[model samples]
Target: MKEELIVKAYEVAKERYAAIGMDTDKAMDALQKVQLSLHCWQADDVTGFESAGELTGGIQATGNYPGKARNIEELRQDVLKAASYIPGNHRLNLHEIYGDFGGQFVDRDQVEPKHFESWMQWAAEHNMKLDFNSTSFSHPKSGSLSLSNPDKSIRDFWIEHTKRCRAIAEEMGKRQGDPCIMNLWIHDGSKDITVNRMKYREILKNSLDEIFATEYKNMKDCVESKVFGIGLESYTVGSSDFYTAYGASHNKIVTLDTGHFHPTESVADKLSSLLLFIPEVMLHVSRPVRWDSDHVTIMNDDTLDLCKEIVRCDALDRVHIGLDYFDASINRIGAYVIGSRATQKCMLQALLEPLDTLRKYEANDQGFERLALLEEAKSLPWNAVWDMFCLKNNVPVGEEFIAEVEKYEAEVTSKRN
Candidate 1:
């Protein structure tokens, strides 16, 4: 991690890449410009400030790691600490339940932008932007279904909540001078076989139409889908096809969570198709072990493929990348650093690819050469470039961040009783 070593390695890497008709400086510049949205729930294990029941809706945070943020101040401190190790300035993704309700119960149906004024002030103070999500799980009304609930009363309650969420997102966007990406994901499904699938989807479509009835200038709306949840294995109301079709027809952005699909399903392959139709796409990058466990993301094949496809399609500006995982089993700050840095590494690798050369091989019908070049590209000195990026950003390079997280745990988080 020495300055001389970093500079020398980067020079060598630059030369090697230049030989392949790639520019390391341009790749580094592009990598630095891509801002990822860090999820807030990671600091507190999805246990928002709202006085809700245990985590439900087929989601659960599994560990009891100490030093978890007990309030907004502590959570902000933790996120800022995590950001220090990450490479670039990023936005924070907030859930409705994380609003500053002042210890008073503000039910989802009646929640408003006032509840999040403090967050907006805090984000502005830190020079950070924000994104929003409608909290549709772990509430008394979240049993069995939400927007697609059979009962009109239950469905209306969620509809109102979502409408208020969008309104809040708009205010945040206007305040920050950027469009807040408001993502709506509901765990509406059946634990057992249900015969009313069509009926539920129809209700969902109607609810979405009503929620999006009023357009705001500063917020962009996105709909997310999942394969299944813990108990909701029998049926997932918002499947991929449902959201893809709905997003296309309604002119809304579709969010693709990496862990929301089957293990064998290629999330990368879906990007090209979705990009052609949707105006934009949002990514909830997470690591799913055997199922949607929501483990912290790493530099694995799933993530690599996802980043590669995005670069291949030249969809850097068209896609919104956000980390979506909460592993309370480890140090929360470490989890954030690992996942965020790993994502950046994957993007750096993708950006360093000699796409022009590889594409030329494909265009010339040289399949074998194309395949060989890709294999060779894997062994390129992308790590040296990544180290330089961290150095330039004034963050710990390589495994040095591990010690920093430990130091914070001892000095800051461990004292929280």
Candidate 2:
């Protein structure tokens, strides 16, 4: 590791030691071990550490992660191995290896019941779990039955697929006794500003009803906060118009993508508000890049610090963490490797901070009100946290990225732009 990083690690360790009232020597020893583990895992590339290594280590592919262009078995192995990097503990609640909704266009039906059975066996060996979400049924070439067409046959086909997939998930979980969610998203929203909005409402309700009737009824149903496309339209799930439509006021929950909440609220505020409706958020943790660029960078200090605050408030147990990363610039393997490791590291640091901080508060004879006060004390701006981590890691933020962000000010930057 670089000398700067070593110093920074020591600083973090010293702060924790002081907070916990532990002897400096003991704190240093513990933090040193953590630091060394990080260095060994992330400092350099180890032999046989292929991006695909994640699955071989035992994680299962949950959703749209498989591509027509990739080998299913290979992708499955890489996902599992990526999961292995998570430190095991109830406190270390890194849920499942999550994938997006892109599989609608691919022929996943080829994997069949047999392939799922084999994969379940593989997951059992590694102690990993699988979680998945379906892409909007309306995407072109997704082969989704179109309720918009008002054809019963088309609608039935779509409903059948949903039911079959749910059954498959149930079967897998029954064997493994691990949790999984068959998440749903629909591209059903008015496209043209001049279009009749009522038509889209019918379409949305119909699709959701079909999903709700599936075999995965017992599993948690998560509605995504989308990044773009038709579903992001004014009446779509992520917009204000669809917020109520999302069943947010009901028992069903909504998932929050940290990067997706940009320009709306800082991650901390989003977490605070989101916790009210859905304690367990299906998170899409990635770097907040320019408009429409969901480049899967590791969690930065800004986001990590906010996530830490959320965890401190006991909001973590309510949510499951998913590495929702998709970056075409870097192949899937590189994206998964860097993004997964970075997220795990940030989670570790975030988890460690609060335990130490709370220990200090408790030892000081602080009451629960003081704990609330600690939350107030920890309420530093996201940018300040970002600066601290960047400084510690010697990570560079590019000027081009800054320029792209500036251009998005005052105007909505479309993905095409």
Number of the top-ranking candidate, with lDDT as the measure: 1
Instruction: Report RMSD for candidate 2.
Output: 11.6
Clashes per candidate, residues 3 or more apart or on different chains? 0, 13
Alpha-carbon local distance difference test for all models: 0.95, 0.44
TM-score of each: 0.99, 0.61
RMSD of each: 0.9, 11.6
For residues 11-125, could you state the per-residue lDDT of candidate 1 as single tens digits?
9999999999999999989998999999999999999999746899989898998999999889999999999999988999999999999999999999999999999999999
Those runs of model 1 whose alpha carbons end farther than 4 Å from true positions after fitting are none
